[model samples]
Target: MNFEVVLTCAVTGAGDTTGRSKHVPVTPEEIARDAVEAARAGASVVHLHVRDPQTGKGSRDPALFRETVDRVRQSGVDVVINLTAGMGGDWTPAKDDWAMPGPGTDMIGPDERLAHVRDCLPEICSLDCGTLNFGNDDTIYISTPPILRRMAALVREWGVKPELEVFDLGHIRFAKAMLAEGLLADPPMFQLCLGIPWGADQTVETMAAMKAQLPPGASWAGFGISRMQMPMAAAAVALGGNVRVGLEDNLFLGRGVLATNAQLVEQAREIIERMGARVLSPQEARNRLHLRGADA
Candidate 1:
């Protein structure tokens, strides 16, 4: 097991989870508040996704991102910020004509997809490595090679680290190719995304398999959705990797018990401590991962 772990709390995801949990932050103020609270509860990093306050849906609006990041920065918390660059790739084809776009389609070019990342300039922004059938529906998340290369280059140019989000082995393979092409910087960062449909399963074996494929000296974290969140975090720790947790992935602190972002971070911290691992501070994480730092 790794002696030191960087714990990340994904404050609020763009999923349909607000109705189920009142603790889910919807507005910039709420998201920022929870992110600060989570940091105080022992989260080294707070991964963020802006939501439309009126509709409680995920949004890629740069204004919303700016407000959220500003609030977090001004809150006096010293945690590292990580913004999501995984939106604007939803594609739900029309039933009648597969050739035409559908109601759920919100596909855009790489530049537009990274609009919020450019607007916020967080220390880390996610880059989903490939396309996948999202949520067992007609919806598919697209991130082709050309688009990923461009996005990686742009983030590198901006001095923002791209957290390569790999959902499966193939995604890891492609991410390796990107690294080979010199699109990613040294000591590449990775997020092993699991439990989503059509992606890798939420299990120790799966996380281990995916972790084995990462490039040497890469900094990585792994997370599983729903009930497997904490288990996967423990598994990640045991496998010599970092951990990610929050309401963005799991909603319950226990069976029939709803969780807030801070609560989730607290629980993950407890697990890490019980396993005899130290939770790294934001600066420690920055130094260990070779990040561009919080100011960047």
Candidate 2:
């Protein structure tokens, strides 16, 4: 078992949960505050995604990302910031013409997607390795091979570690291919995102299968959405991997119990401690992941 675990708090995701729970941070200030609080609550890293303050929708705006990152850095916290480069890839086809994108489509080139990474120079940024049906019918998330390669190369160029986001088995395969092609560095980091519809299910069998497929010596974490958040964190820890938790993946502390980012981090920390493992500090996590400080 991995005795020392790195816990990541996903401060606010691109999910439309703002109306469902008022705790989801919408503005840059709110997002930064939650990230700092989560770090103080035992999160070694904070995965971030900015949302439109007025509409509560997901955004890929570099200005918003800069504001949030700046606030977090200015707070004097030492937590690792893992920004999401998984935006600008939602492709919902048009009803009349399949080639044309519909109202929900937000697809863009690789450069636009990583604009924030270049601007912020975060220590870590995610690169979704494959395209898949995102949610309901007709909605697809398009992360083509060429796009991923371009994004990965840019991430390397920026001197930031790529947290390869794998939502399914094929995505893992693509990640390995990218590694073989020299698009990623050694000891690549992965996030086994389970429990999303049309992707991998939240079960031990699925987690074990995906974990087994990871490259040897790769540092990885796993997370489950909704009610399976805590359960998946425990599973990941027990299976010799790190864990992720927060409002991004789950909103409730218990049945109908709304949770803040700090509370979720604390809850995961308690579970890790009770399970005979230690939650790593940000510096310790950086060392384990072979990352220099963001300032470096």
My TM-score estimates for the predictions, one after another, are: 0.98, 0.98
lDDT of 1 at 30: 99
At residue 21, give the lDDT of candidate 1. 94
Identify the runs in model 2 with alpha carbons over 4 angstroms from their true place.
Answer: 294-296
Each prediction's whole-model lDDT (CA): 0.94, 0.94
Write one digit per residue (lDDT tens) for candidate 2, span 1-296: 77999999999999889999989999999999999999999999999999998999999999999999999999998899999999999988899999999989998999999999999999999888899888877989999999999999998988899999999999999999999999899989999999888899999789999999999999999999889999999999999999999999999999989999999999999999999999999999998997757224
Give candidate 1 regions above 4 Å deviation. Answer: 294-296
